[model samples]
Target: MNNPFPYSEDNKRYYTWSHYLKTKYKNKVFKVALNANFTCPNRDGTCGVGGCTFCSSYGSGDTIEDKFEPLDVQYESNLKIMQHKWPKGNAIAYFQAYTNTYGSVKQVSEMLKPFLFKDEIVAISLATRADCLSDEMIEYLDFVSRKKDIWIELGLQTTNDKIAKSLNRGHDYQCFLETVERLSKTNLKICVHLMNSLPGESKEDMIQNAYKVGQLPIHAIKIHMLYILKDTVLGKSYLQHPFPMLDKDDYIDVVVSQLEVLPKHIIIQRLTGDGMRGEQIGSEWMFKKTIVLNDIDKAMVARNTWQGKVLETK
Candidate 1:
């Protein structure tokens, strides 16, 4: 069957990040994940304590081989690994670990200045919290974006305030909306993260979370499944008192529904996430990422739907 999605070049019913980068750069482009050694307000005393219930001790930097190394060293090492796969591709300097923007503007400037002029770097993506972005930081990012593409990745796992509180997420939906509005006026691109199967969140809740955020002036979205890790608060709680998690079939169903609601223009950066094999306590089905993604594509074809189908109907 032919793919109906305007932004896709293959059978994908959703707009993939690969398609976006290829179209923009006119060649292969990959992200090099870097750890800036920043901390989150949720982890420190600034917001609350113990970090997010689902986050691991590495602040979700489990994939980084040596996170404690200096930024230049980390970038060179990770870039080599990525280049081994796509030798001709350009790189996006992805600040993936912790709240990269939680520090002072000067600290953030110093951390990012070197990469801004690097020949191999095409863009810089910073993973941060909505509350961490100050006006000064936004302005600085906007100024720098004039020279290079700057992407601000904000983690808003779920839209439900009750679920947000239960997860110990420092801010509410309002805070996310306010931050997005502020960032919308800048040259920076925005990517919001959402999670399915959050505790107490139904399939309908997950769909609405995508629908609500889809209406915002965001450039992209990353939809992840809530995988339990052994070291997290959620993991300990689950070990003591088990809660229901989405099986592979159900997860595929929910993800396909989420894609139908999101606009075709917004890039779908990630459909699922990888959990450290030794550290994961539940959701074993997530390990088979390829099969899960294939099933989602098959389901979308069977349903005769594409991304933004529901939006067009509305």
Candidate 2:
């Protein structure tokens, strides 16, 4: 089994650090999830009150309150962790956890000033909602892309409008297309966040959604299995019905089929993301993160399959 892509050492689709970065710098790049302290439109009453049911008030990822902490401190901590772990890698400042592009242009500028001249930070990846990227935000992103590489991660849990509404996503499918169109005009790379095993979603529905995403102007893809975490609407609902979630085998088939239709050029950012176990409810297997991802990789390799192997032209 021989696949040139570092990701496919065994003639299968697997995540490898070398193939993952695909960088020429001969080093690793770190991601620092910046607490941008930005608020969402949903929380501001412009769209809705409580944000997406699955989103914690602080947004996802490890978060710390204390707005007083200087941005450099946070960046330093993240860089330290990466350096300690890899020792030879560089770093990238990830404005994660919330709508990084929500604030005013001036505010965003100020928030990112600390890393402006940091050579170790080679790129910046922003995690944000499709609707939150305003014209000014685009301008900022455009400006940043010229100076440094940029990646914008848009959260598109499912293409199903009903599920999006149930999750209180605040934006619609049209909005997602519009956002991508707008961002396409920029030089930044766009990565999409797709969730599987979401409530009210069937196998056919998930496949359709993945195909739809493959048609978008996306540079990368990140997939995660939905988990009903504690203190969320999803968690409460799961307790009531306990509808089946994708187990290990189910997930492998779903992922392979989805990948069969996914564009191969699109780097697979992640196959799954494990939410904090203490806060996660139901689907305990999610806690076995490494084993699950490894199993998926092994299965795909054994079958000699890559994403988008199966597609139907409509």
Candidate 3:
């Protein structure tokens, strides 16, 4: 593959997270996802109720194993999978379920304490909402960022407040901005999650959100298309009245356009995300994830473009 991006080994036209990890660790590093047994404010009525309309029962940590087991057991279980996938690789324990830092700073600390001592764990990734973070949480995360690699994945979805309201996102755009500003002070690697083809959002809306997050001090991003899952609010709505979804071709175009508008230095963590085959309902294109990603790569090459290719240089 022609890796013209200069930051990857494949034909990917953007800076890939895998490339960055390998370069930083000098070898392959995997994130062994763990279920920390946390709940979201959206689900618990702190922010609203019933959680985001699209979230699954696993709190988006569906890949995590042994939810009922201790952290040590979960770590070893995921480690075995990673070892088989990449036998020579190092790893980091990823606290991926719900609002990992929603609890008190002390509680969050205890959940992370075991992973801190693991020689094989090179970094820690926290997946949570920006508004869920408190001052105490930020202070503790900042402290850990100084000691080891601490990457925070904030679920921004889209910066459009209207869409946020429609999805029952609980927080507004300003809240996400404020949260980013706070985390910026710590200088930790931040990755934002973005969604495409959301209800009531046009293609332009997604591109503008891409432009906005690109201007932030974020180090990476994960781009996902909205997928309606069964037993959720979105699923109920879809059953009542089906909403338009991006097809495979349209999705690839949107993803490529997002990449073109983003800053080249921002690592592309994932091009798209998926729910379980059985649970996922809308956006049937999600089933062909590999093909969709390949299409994006091929489209970028055909257009002779790459990340930041459309951005105006100062």
RMSD of each: 0.9, 2.5, 1.6
Best by lDDT: 1
- Per-residue lDDT of model 1, residues 116-202, tens digit only: 999878999999999999999999999999878999999999999999999999999999999999999988999999999998999
Q: Alpha-carbon error at 138 in model 1, in Å?
A: 0.3
Worst-scoring 10-residue span by lDDT in model 1:
1-10
Model 3 lDDT per residue over 149-199, tens place: 889999889998988988888999899999899989885779999989888
Poorly placed runs, candidate 3 (over 4 Å): 1-4
In angstroms, give how far residue 168 of model 2 lies from its true place: 0.4
Candidate 2: list runs displaced more than 4 Å. 4-20, 63-68, 311-314
Residues 1-314, candidate 2, lDDT per residue (tens digit)?
66523456434563433465645455666676677677788778889977788887677754543333667776777677668887877777888876888878888788777676788877888888899888888988789777778889999889889999989889899999999999998898898999999878988888888889988888888888987777776677777868778887888678777877786677777777777758887677877878877888777777777665564332
Q: In model 2, what are the clashing residue pairs, if there are any?
A: 259-307, 259-308, 260-308, 260-309, 261-308, 262-308
TM-score of each: 0.98, 0.91, 0.96
Among these predictions, the greatest TM-score belongs to: 1
lDDT of 2: 0.77
Candidate 2, residue 216: Cα displacement in angstroms equals 1.2
